[model samples]
Target: MKRMIVRMTLPLLIVCLAFSSFSASARAASEEKYWDHWIERHAQPLDASNASNKDLRFLKKVLKGKRIVQLGETTHGAGEINATKVRMIKYLHEELGYDVLAFESGFPDTNASYLNMDQLTPKSTMKNSIYAVWHTEDVVELFDYMKEQKEKGDPLILTGFDIQSMKNSFNVAATQWVKAVDPEKAELLSQSENDFSTLVTDSNTFDEFSQKKEKLVKNYQKLIKFTKTHASELKENLPKEPKAYEMFMHSLQLRIDVMETYMLEEMKEKLEEYPENIEDFSFFMRDRMMAEQFQWVADTLYPKKKIIVWGHNYHLRKQNTKMIKDWVQLNGPNMGDYLPERLKKQTYTIGIYAYSGASLDSSDNKTVKPVTSPPPSGSLEALLKAADRPAVFVDFLHTKNKKGTSWMYTPRTALYWGYMEEQMILKEQYDGVIWLEHITPSVIIK
Candidate 1:
C-alpha cells in the first residue's frame, strides 16, 4: 500500500510542475509580444538634440484639438524631465496654441508672477512666486520664452492652482479686506496675522499652526462673512477686472480654508484615541481645491484657449484608485479624478516615466542621486524600457492598436515624492505617457 501511494504522489507532483512551467513560459511570451507590438505601433520617437520642426509637428498631431494638456513628472525635482517638459510647452504653445501655463504653485503668488514676468527677470519672478524646486535654469528659460512671446503680441498667462501661498499674500489680503470694509477690525486681523506668522516663522512643521486651532477657524469665519457682505460692491467696482477680483477673493478664501482644514484634522488626531479615516478627507480637500482652480482657469478664464498644466504625476493623474484605496481605505478621488467629470474628453493627462537615473531626493535636501531601486517587473516603466526606445511618447488613450492598451489598466509603478508605489493604473491614471531612458536631477539655481 505504501509503495503504491508513493508512486502515485510522484507522478502527480511531476504533472503539477510541468503545468507551472508551461504557464510561466506562456506569460513571459505574452508580455514580450505586448511590448513589441506597442513599440512598433504606438511609440513615437523624440529628437533629444533640438526641437526639430518635425518633432514639433509630431507633438502637434498628438496634442491637436485637446483643450487641456496636463504634463506630469515622476519626481518633483528632476531637471531632465523639466527640460523635456519645457520643450513640450514650447511646442504646445507655438504649434498647438496653448495659452496658459497653469502651475502647481501658490494661487495668490501666481498673480505676482504674471504681473512681474514682463517687468522682472525670470529668476526674480520665480523666486517671488513659484516653489523652490521650480527655481531652475529650465524654468527660468521657460519664463524668458513666455515673456518674449507675450511681447510679440501673443499673450501667455502664468497662473497657479495650489493652496500653499506664502505668508506675505496672507497678510496683504487680510489687510486689504479690513481696510476695505471694517477698519475697526484691523487690529483684530493684525493679531491673527502675527499669531500665524509667528508659528510659520518659528517652525518648519505645522505643529504650531495646528496648536492655534480656534484662531484659524475664527479668522476663516470672519473672512467668509466679510466676503459675503461686500460681494456685490467688490464685483461692481472691478467691472473690467472681475476675474482678477474673483481670483483674489478665491485665493484668500482657499488659504484660510486649507489652513483651517489642517488645523481641524490636527485637533481630531490629538483628540481621538483611535482616529477615523481622515486620509480621504484631507486628500479630497486639497485635490478638490486644485480642481476648482483648474476649472476656473479653463472654463471661467479662458474658455476658448488650450491650457498646459505642470505638476507631479500623482496630482495630475485622472485616476487614483490605488492611492484612494490604500490611503483612505475607500474609493475616494483626486485632482484629475475630479476634473474629468467637469471637463469630460477635453482633459488629457500625460505621465512621464524613466527606466533609471538620478533625481533630487525631496525627502532630504540632497541633490542628484540614483533611483532607490530599479523598475519593478511588470511595471509600465519596465514595459516602456523594454520597447528599446531612448525617448518616446505613447498615446494609450487614443491608440489605433487597442491591443497595446490592454495592459494599461493593470496596476504599475508610480514614483512620487522620492518613493515608489507599485499599484498605479496607467491607462486609467493618464491619457498618454512620455518615457525617457535616463533622468537627471534639477539644478538648484541659487
Candidate 2:
C-alpha cells in the first residue's frame, strides 16, 4: 500500500512541474509579443549610406502625400544620424519633390545666409550661418549637398527656427529693417542698443538678462513701438522683384517677438518657488513660435510646398513624452504638439533611437566623449533588439490592425544630451521610430 501511494504521488508531482514550466514560457512570449510582431514582421531595415537607394522606395511609400515630415534625432550630433538625415533630404528632394529643409537654428543666424547662398561658398556660409557645435564633417557634407542643389537651379529653401543668437542678430536685422524703411527713426533703434549688447554677451547671457529683466522688457517695448509706428514704411520698402529680403525681415521681427514673449514669461515665473511652470511656458512658447514660423513659410513663402524639418527628438515629437515630465507634471504639449494640430494628417514624425553609443558632451568649453550604456530590462531599446535587426523602421501610424500595442503607453527609455529618461512614452510621442543597434559620436570640427 505504501509503495503504490509513493508511485502515484511521484507521477502527479512530475505532471504539475511540466504544467508550471509551460505556463511560464507562455507568459514570457506574451510579454514580448507586441514588440516582436512590430519589429520582426512589420519593421523595414534602413541603409543610411548616400549611395544606397534601396530604402527610398519604402520611405516614399511611407511618406507618400505627406506635406510635412519631421525627422528627429536621439542626440544633436551623431555621425550616422546626421548622415541618415542628409540621405533622407536627398531622397525626399529627388523622389518626393520636397523643396524646403527647415532647421533647428536661430532665424537671423541662418536665414539670410542660406537665402544669399550665391554670394558665399558653402564652407563660408556654413561657418557663419550656424553655431560652432554644428561645424561637423556630416554638416559640412549637408551644406555642400545644398550648394550643389542650388547650383542645379532646383534650390532648396534652407531656414532656421531657433532663437539662441549670440551676436544679437535680431538687433542687427531690426536696425537694418528700420534703416531701410524709416532712416530718421533708425536712430531711435539705437536707444536700446546698449541693453541689447548686454544681452548679446557670450558668457552667462541668460543670467545677465534675468538680472536686467525690466530693461529687457523696456527694450522690447521700444522695438515694438518703433516697428508699429513705421509699419507702413517698412512694408513699402520691401523689395518686390525678389521677396527674400522681405521674408528675412518678417522672420527677424517674428523671432524678436517670440524672444520678448519668452522673457516676459520667464520674469513671471520668478515669483514661484519651484519654477517648473516657467520652463514649460518657455517650451510651449518656443514651439508655438517655431510652428508659426513654419506656417508662414508654408503659406506665404512657398505655397503648397513639401517641407522636412530635422532636429532633436524632444522638439520634434508630436506628443510630450517623459522627457519634460519631471516633478512638475503639466510640462507640455510641446512644439510637436502644436505643429500636428495645424498640419493634421499632413504631418508625419519619425524619432531615431540608438541602443548604445558615444554621446557628445560640450557643456564644458572642452568637448569630451561619453559612452552610452545599454537600456535596462523591459525598456524600448531592449525590445527593439529582440527583433535581431541592426537597424529598423517601425511605422506605428501607418500600421493597421496591430494587436497588443497598449504596452507602449507605459514608459520606455530615451536618451538626450547625455541624460537618459527611463519612462518615455515611445509610441504616443512619434508616428514612427528609426532604431540603430549601435551609434558613433559626431565628428567635431576642430
Report the number of the highest-lDDT candidate. Answer: 1
Q: For model 2, how does the per-residue alpha-carbon lDDT over 1-446 read when each residue is reduced to its tens digit? A: 99999998999999999998677546545655666665676667777652767766787778877898898987776677777778778888888899888788766667766755766777767776776666778888888889898889886778776755545444444466578876765655655544544443322445655556556556556656766676677656542325555554565365457446754455455543234554357656777777676667766776678988887777788766345352125546667666546575688899888877765654532354553566766666677776677777877776543344534544455655434553566667778888878777777775
TM accuracy, model 1? 0.78
Residue 78 deviation, candidate 2, in Å?
Answer: 1.7
TM-score of every candidate: 0.78, 0.76
Which pairs clash inside model 1?
Answer: 79-442
lDDT of 1 by residue, 1-446 (tens): 99999998999999999998677546544665666676766678777686465754766666666788999987877877888898888888877888888999877778655654565777777776777787789888888887788789786678888866655644544455456556655566656656654544454444554556456657756766776687775554332332656665666566566666643453444444233553435556677778877887788777887889999887788766545233234546667766747585887889887877888866553666676456676666667765677888888777642444556644455555334544655666778998887877888788
- Global lDDT scores for all candidate models: 0.69, 0.67
Q: Which stretches of candidate 2 lie over 4 Å from their true place?
A: 1-34, 168-197, 200-242, 267-280, 321-330, 362-371, 401-411
| Model 1: residue 174 alpha-carbon error in angstroms | 8.9
